[model samples]
Target: MSFTVLMYHEFRKRGDIDATSPSTISVEQQYQDALPKVLFSYIDDFKEQMMYLKTEGYHTLTLQEIKDFYEKGTQFPEKSVLLTIDDAFQSVYQYAYPILKELQFHAVSFVVLGWLSNEREYFDPSISKVMSKQELEEMLDVVELGNHTTHLHKRYPDGTSEMQATSLQELKKDLAECGEYVTYPDVFAYPFGIYAPKDIERLAETGIKYAFTTVPGVNTASTSVLELHRDTVTLGCTLENFKTIVEKGASK
Candidate 1:
């Protein structure tokens, strides 16, 4: 059967930025207030969502399982699914990790290398605090970490250039440095879910086997390693919406 991979970011409580909003400013505010309590609320919802998936006969798969099924022609259980989180938000450690451990589920995390040693607020201005090195190390014990990029770029008015090739290379170098700290898997998540065909080729050259995009779709046997689409789980997605995406499937 075809598989659906769900991509998530911060799971905050009442105050954290809602992933569903189109307006970046409002979302920024929400991200700033992402406290442990707020993060846990969404973790609760995520658990409930997983339970729903189980009832629907969906089997959660790791990225490697999906790869083996498609590339090596391995057999997968029915209703296979994969879970991934992009941008190493503190909430993943504070909230999501415990939930995954409880359910015995596995997930992949794409981390920004530059953000590792610095304070959280330095990387994503929306965050008030950052996860410390010790905290990140602890997280590594539970989840698979991948490259997100080094300096997460901002819009022109906000700071520097938009995501260009030069910026992409810089990000690549940042990821390489991050690899020194953590032995990330051969996977990547395009920052801001933004990428061009050239970017995909560039990533491939970096020894990345799988690069995930926020292109809002499902994966079939024919899907390519580059331009792999993901169904983003944001604030606007209700449990019903999540179900429809998983059941109906996604495409490029």
Candidate 2:
């Protein structure tokens, strides 16, 4: 069987949802899909999953480590799982980062530079605040940072994919900005989990060694290096569901 690579998004503590916060208010108003139930995760659930991995004897691997196994025949420890989070949510520092450090596991965050802010980059009052520079510097102890593009996470009104919207120039430029901002490995987790075949060519031109997608499956040596799949952990995921994701993926 192949090893797993888990994907996660924003996280919120079970007891700490401030109903009156601008970020909360903004989602409560404009974006129906922004409900906390689906968009953010409970901190307790994250802890329990990590605990399961520990007690069950899973080895946490970074994307690079996994890549080595796939591309160069390097061997990883048994029950290897690569953990990744996208969107650079500030909640990661408060929730996932501490738990990962405490558990002595490693994770990677694919940061969308557009999401950073003094408070946050989006919303009227900027609600969904991403990690600050100081906090990110500290979080490096537990997490690696990768590119998630600068501003391609958002969708156009016509609903065309951002990477496919232009003549490949804008796509390269967006990735360039990400390279300039997010420093570390030359990995990329596609924004919006959407891409075209041409996008693969574009990625190579920009020094991207690996890319992640929203697809579900355990990655083996046969899996494509640029379009590797990941198991998504969401707010609704129970331990059983999480286990299935780690084992069988979202669909059988």
Candidate 3:
């Protein structure tokens, strides 16, 4: 059996980003879209998507299951689905949480540990607040929290990503600092879906078993655990396209 891992960035009460919204800035923000307010799934659309999953016989699975299958040839659960929300935006707690709880569905979140510790903005000031430690603790029953590096989720002045540019030593240090939050059998989702070949080797050395990318596809035993792909649901995604994206995948 195979599975699909999905990536979500933020949640919005309104169904669409208005021209005046902070996230819909006139100036282009390519890097940040990869981080925080890059793409937003409104509460309504999210609800519809989850409802479809619930009624359509789709069930959630953990990244560990995919890792076990790829590394040990364990059989994946039938009709497995994995939902991952990147950056741990507060809206996940606010808008996405209740609906998921109501449906009794689980999701994995890749949180930036550094964003949680300091008083800082991840992107648009109005929408980038991250969840607190207490909030994270409270949601543990349904949310599988994973490490998304400590401080290297940011972008450099030359448009290079911190994850792509940081030294191995620095990356290790950041991962150690983030260890306070990450639990066992750690899984990582790349910042902006970006990674290099050495990044895979580095992840193995770091004891990270699963790392995900934003590439569109479902996971099979042959899928590279270090470079697993996921589909991002944008606000423009129609319900029909959403279903197609999940059942198969977005055709490249």
- Candidate 1: stretches off by over 4 Å: 15-41, 55-57, 118-129, 152-163, 167-172, 182-185, 250-252
- Candidate 3 regions exceeding 4 Å error are 19-38, 117-125, 249-252
> Residue-wise lDDT of candidate 3 within 1-252, one digit each (tens)?
667777887787663345244452211112343233437777898999999988887778765666677778887546668888887777787788889889999898887776663332233435456766666666777888887888788666675678878787888788777766766336888877777788889888887777888898876766777888898887656899888878883112
Candidate 2 local lDDT, 63-112, one digit each (tens): 66765776678877767788988776667777788899999999988887
Q: Using Cα atoms with residue i matched to residue i, what is each candidate's TM-score against the true structure?
A: 0.76, 0.83, 0.85
lDDT, each prediction: 0.63, 0.72, 0.73
By lDDT rank, best first, the candidates go 3, 2, 1
Best-to-worst TM-score order: 3, 2, 1
Separate clash counts for every candidate: 10, 0, 1
Candidate 1, residue 145: the lDDT equals 72
Using lDDT as the measure, the top candidate is: 3
Badly placed stretches (over 4 Å) of model 2 are: 15-36, 118-127, 248-252
Indicate the worst ten consecutive residues by lDDT in candidate 3: 24-33
The TM-score between candidate 3 and the true structure equals 0.85
